[model samples]
Target: MKRWYVWLGAAVSLVFLYFALRGLQLQQVWAGVRTANYWWLVPGVAVYFLAVWARTWRWHYLLRPVQRVSLRNLFPILVIGYMGNNVYPARAGEVIRAYVLKRRERVDMSPSLATIVVERIFDGVVMLFFVFVALPFTPLPEWMRRTVVLSSALFFGLLLAFFILAASPRQARAVYVWAVGRFVPEAWRPRVTAVLDRFMDGLGCLRSGRDVAMVFVTSVAIWLTETVKYWFVMHGFGFSVPFYVLMLMAAVVNLATTLPSSPGYVGTFDGPGIAILAAFGVQAALAASYTLVLHAALWFPITALGVYYMWHERVSWSDFGAAERARRSEPEVVGTEMRDARQREVR
Candidate 1:
């Protein structure tokens, strides 16, 4: 059911993009592309790679409480994961990356997944911060303003929820069990509870103050580097948009990806990218061209690299398919164990 919704959303986004691009002049877009300063593109791509490296380091920080892994070892895996996300839909690359870490480094998938979730929350918050800060400078519409505010609130709310869960795992587990029991059959409740418990254990990484601070700092740095990438891309196209404006737009585009979309975020990404620039008074043709270039900068290289890495690592498609299947078939053993242990203590 959820998967169907993702596909439907992707279709809708594509339809929206088709209409959006229909009346635009191809020649103007071509001119914009032809006039772009290819020199800046090289630096832009390099900065983007730096952003990826910073993100990998942040992930390592998140995993520090459980186990230490070097950024050197993790960087290639991270790149490959991003590549997987571009090639496959439903962000299957994420699961693949977790499986890689689990298989290669012997890292537990639960905590690795938790680290990914933490990474997302940090990304959301930083992106929101940039968007809200740049809102006043850009000539945004009322509707767009409302959307940003609401979206910012949503991400902030998620951050709050994560902290709450991190603060009290035992209570969170109890509440989870009660909720599951209401819907799941009696025979299956215990097993489900176990899985949830294991999942919750992943949140334990957030309990350390040093780790929390490191995650926050690294997240900010990563977003700032991403903003630089956006700025360079704009410069590559000969646009002199303010750095703040570029940052805000970058945040907006990043936020757009949180929605369900096709693999590589095709339509969903380009729509928001063009819209944000147009709102800032960029010409439609230039904006469209900019969107394509920006998308290429972020998606294309990683994908090419990911394909190469996937082949080099000998990660067959069947291996990923099997991982997905295993995830579905396995009982919620981890969560159940935590729940039972808590229950025993309570009694």
Candidate 2:
């Protein structure tokens, strides 16, 4: 099943890549790549890491109500997870990160993963802000505009439903048990219910408006800081698109990557980005070149840093394999809350 899914994702990736690279302008693409200020990447990478640091800080806030892990401790786990995401499919790195926390910090896997879900949800909301805020400036195709609006409604609906459930664990508990019980084998209900209890406990932070607000603010900071990286990268190409436009690209592209795609988000990351920049009057070759380099910048530095930390922490491929196995066995308390991706992104 996993191999089948990976192959399917690869097919989707090829389709997106074809769109991203359709025009035969290798000369222009190479010209764009060669006559560039490579030095801009220095600050681009730095700003990217800063955004990641803010993510760590926000995760710290989320995990505090659960087990109180320190940012220092969580940061590497976060990077490792990001690294895993880059190399693996289905963003399995998230699962690996939770597994690592359980191993290193003695945190329970279910709740730790729940915190990641919360992270993704807040990320979705923040990225939506970026999209809606910049919408008036970018004249997207009608199809693209409708896609964004529909997606916004879907994300808002999901968050609202999740908020209501997290805010009322008793009702959530009943709903979960009753819903799952209707399908699960009779003997499995008790174990599933127990997992639901732990999962709800993980969402304890949601009971406070302040905590949600903090998560939202930190999420904005993280994306905006990363947007600064996008801004910096644009300088390399001598393209001076407005910062908000870049934010919109960052928002749309990263959100697109959350969909199933090849490892490292190959086509998924580059395609929408190229399309968006093209819509903004960037020539196709230049847009493709810019998007490709940006993808490399996004995929490489943190991935290398993650590998460094993985080696330092004595984590191995075996550990990676172990994490996948652990995922198959982890309990899903609430069907999609603890089960489905709250969503995804790095920009």
Candidate 3:
């Protein structure tokens, strides 16, 4: 299934690349890239790291209910996790990051995974918020609007479900039993339920309205900082869009990254960004060049930093595989006693 996901992502990226490149002059795109002032990228990259720091703080806040991890300690783990996402398929970096947290902070994996899920959902909500904020001024194409609507349904739906799960455990369990109980074998049900309970523990922050608001506020700040990078990079390429348009582009491209794509989000990020610019009246070649450079600017520095942190932390490439195995083994480890008790009862 993992291998299948990798291939599917590659194929999806190829499709996006085709559209991104279609009818564009390759030479003009290269020319635009070659002539751009590179100095703007310095500040762009700097602002991006600030956003990463904010992200670490957000994760730190979310994990506090389960375990109080220091932001200084969490930063490198967050960077390494992002690096893993850039290089690995299926956002496996999420699992790897959670595993690293376990190794470093002695936090349980399921709850950490739950916290990560909360981060993703909030991020999606923020991205969609950007889109709507820009909609009136930016005049997005119909397809983009439709995409936002669908994504809104998904992210909001998830937020509601998680709120229900975290706020009302008994109700959640009853719903789970009604929906999924029969499918799970009696021997495995105890383990599954226990793992889910731990996962819900990760969502403890959501039970408090203030914490949820803080998460949303911090999420908004993160993306706004990232959109600043987009604005800076836009200056480098010698064409300019309004700040809100940059916000729209940032939101659209990042949302596009949520689609299946090759490592580093490849064509998925570039295509939507280019399309957004083109729709906004920028020349296709200029949009392509700017989007390509912006994509690299966004991808490389943090990824390199992540690698350095991985080395400093003594984590290796093999650790990613280990993380995957660890995640799969969590249920077995947590459920062992329950499973044995059921067996004893049967005997």
Candidate 4:
């Protein structure tokens, strides 16, 4: 079953790859790649790490109501999680990140997972912000326009629901149980409800309106840093796209990557990025060249950093692999036990 998803993801990626490379002159792409000055990537990569640091900062803020972990510690874990996403399928890096946090910081897996969910929601909302702002300026395809509108509505709706749930936790819990009880199997509801409560407990920070605002601002800043990285990389290829265009490209491409694709989001990341750039009037081959190189820059640097930090932390590949398997194989009983163990630690 899992293998099927992998095959399916690989298939989807191939389709996107074909579309991205279709009608493009490879010689031109090669020429673009060969003649480009690589120095700009240095600053691009540096600023990318800064964005990662901002991501770590955001995670730190989220984890505060749970446990206060330092940036030094959290950065690597975040990188490791990203590494997992890059290397593994199904974006299992998320679970791997929660697992690592549980082992190192003794944070509860459920709550740690909750913070990750919140982080994703925040990121999605900000990406939509970029899309809407850029939408008015670009002549996107009909499909792309519909995608942006649907995605915007979806994320905004989720954000509204999240705020409502956070504002009324007690009532939300009742509603959650009632909903879960109606749908979830009788044998599973007890364990499910217990885990759900702990997950909600992790969102304690969201109960404060100020914290929500800070998370939003930090998320926007993080993406802006990412946009600047894109701008720097485009200079290498002479893209000459305005910053807002890159900003929109950053938003659309990153959000597009949330789809199922090969590890590192190969085609899912590149196709839309190139497409968006093309939509903004970049030549097809030039856009392909820029997007391909940009994807490599995004992939290689952070992965190497994750590997370095993995070694620094004495976390072996065997450990990482084991954690991946553990995540895949972890049963409901184990999840409940993990949450119970966390509750005990908190007590």
lDDT: which candidate is best? Answer: 3
In the predicted model 4, the residue pairs found to clash are: none
The TM-score obtained by model 1 is 0.90
Candidate 3 lDDT over 198-301, as tens digits, reads 89889999999999999999999999999999999899999988899888888888888888889999899999889989988899999999999999998899
lDDT of 4 by residue, 129-220 (tens): 88778767777778877888899888888888878888999999999999988999987776777778768878877999899999999999
- As a TM-score, model 3 comes out at 0.95
lDDT of residue 24 for candidate 1 = 85
> Would you estimate the TM-scores of all the predictions?
0.90, 0.93, 0.95, 0.92
Report the lDDT tens digits of candidate 2 across residue range 1-347. Answer: 28988998899899999988887488998888888888999999999999999989988888887798888988999999999999998898988899899889987777888888888878888888998899788777798788888888878887887789788888888889898789889766765776667767778888899988988888999999999998999999987788888999999988888888988999999999998888888888888888889899999998999999899888997898888777556554333443343443322
Candidate 1: clashing pairs of residues: 194-335, 194-336, 195-332, 195-335, 195-336, 197-335, 198-334, 198-335
Q: Which candidate has the highest TM-score of all?
A: 3
C-alpha lDDT values of all predictions: 0.79, 0.85, 0.91, 0.86
| For model 4, the run of ten residues with the poorest summed lDDT | 326-335
Question: All predictions: root-mean-square deviation over Cα?
Answer: 3.3, 6.8, 2.5, 3.0
Q: Give the deviation of candidate 4 from the true structure as CA RMSD.
A: 3.0
What lDDT score is found at residue 73 in candidate 3?
A: 98
